[model samples]
Target: MKIGLYFGTFNPIHTGHMIIANHLAEHSDLDQVWMVVTPHNPHKQKNTLLDDYHRLEMVHLATKDFPKLQPSDVEFKLPQPNYTVNTLAHLQEKYPQHTFSLIMGEDNLNSLHKWKNYEVILQNHSIYVYPRLASGEIDAQFINHPKIHRIGAPVIEISSTFIRESIKNKKNVVPLLPEKVWHYIDHNLFYKK
Candidate 1:
């Protein structure tokens, strides 16, 4: 089984996230897409994030209906401020039979070189990149690399930070998120600081 790991904070797991994950799952060669919930880095001062469990719950709520999409707390099990290489290693170790790859936007692809052990990651796993309205170009090395596949997926502009700020300002962000996730946020009064 080939699993495309789509990592995100998933503050509320909005429709933009759903579209990308679902599109990759259904359109691409990947058998499934795992929405890896990035847990809050306790050392960071970004108080905007909801608790890790809350974000994980929201991801679960968002992905429950899609059989090809799954919610993963794999990072939560690892130490704080975890790196992608480590997470991929953990997943590989835990599920030895499954083949794991990365699902990232063009924006993230531009910064791939800066990631820890990026060369090792490229050597071991394939990367599926989707289009994004990003400022920088994807790294030249990755442009024609055999391991890198540029997928013709839809570009989603919505951001979780924007949604969180809108909710904090008492704006209606219901349409931006999944129905269950919106309800969960409303019930918990998240981001209404």
Candidate 2:
């Protein structure tokens, strides 16, 4: 099986994330797209992040209706400050039968060299990059790489940061998130300021 791993903090899984994942699964050669919920990202600040379990549950709620999309908590049991290279190595050892590819945005591709063992990632797994709102054309270096594939996924400007701010300010987020996800957040009083 070819699985596309869409890694994220998913502070709250919103419509943009869903669209990208679904598009990858439907349009790409991937058999499935797994939303790899990161417990801790080495490059990101942990201050505003919700509990790992909460974020994972939100991903689950948002993806429940899509058979091709599923939520993953593989990073939770790993060490803190999870790195992509380490997770990929672990997953490869555990699921040798599955070929794992990466799903990311153009913005992330801009900083790929900063990631741990990025060269190894590029050599071992394919990358599916979707365009971001303000990101210009992909860098020339990766434009024609055999392992890097640029996809024309529908661009949704909505982001998790925007959703969080709306919730903190008591604004409606129904259109920005899946029905079950919004219900879960409201019922749990999440992101209350």
Candidate 3:
């Protein structure tokens, strides 16, 4: 089985995420996309992040309908300030039978060299990179790597920041999240102080 690891904080899962997972599953060689919910991403701010378990739950709720897409709390059990290299190593040790690939945006691809053990990651794992508007051209140095692939999936501008601000301002976010997910967030007063 070929699995694509779609890692994210998913402060609150939304439709755009689902669309990307579905798009990858249908268009790429990947048979499944595991939405790996990170407890803390070393590259991003951690101050405003929701609880790891809660974020995982939101991802689960949002992706339940797509059998090809699954929500995984794999990084939760691992160490904090989760690093992709470590997670990939652990996953390989845990699931030897399944082939794994990295799923990310072109923006991340541009900064791949700064990541921990990036050379090893690119040499060992295939990457499915979805283009993001205004992300700038993916660096040729990184894109030239044999394992990297530039995906043609349509870009969606939806972002977790936008959703958080909407909730904070008591604005409508129905279009950003799934029906069940919106209800869950509203009931819990998530992102709303």
Q: Which candidate is the best by TM-score?
A: 1
Q: In order, what lDDT does every prediction score?
A: 0.92, 0.90, 0.88
Query: How would you encode candidate 2's per-residue C-alpha lDDT over 1-193 as one tens digit per residue?
Result: 9999999989888999999999999999999999999886656777768888999999988988899998999988898777888899989999999999999999999889888999999989999999888776566778889999999999888888889999999898899999999999999998887
> Model 2 misses residue 50 by how many Å?
1.0
Model 1 C-alpha lDDT per residue in residues 115-156, reported as the tens digit of each score: 999999999999999999873866789899999998988889
Q: Against the true structure, what is each candidate's TM-score?
A: 0.97, 0.95, 0.94
How does model 2 score by TM-score?
Answer: 0.95
Better of 2 and 3 by lDDT: 2
Clash pairs, model 1 backbone: none
- Better by TM-score, candidate 3 or 1: 1
Error of 1 at 111 (Å): 0.9
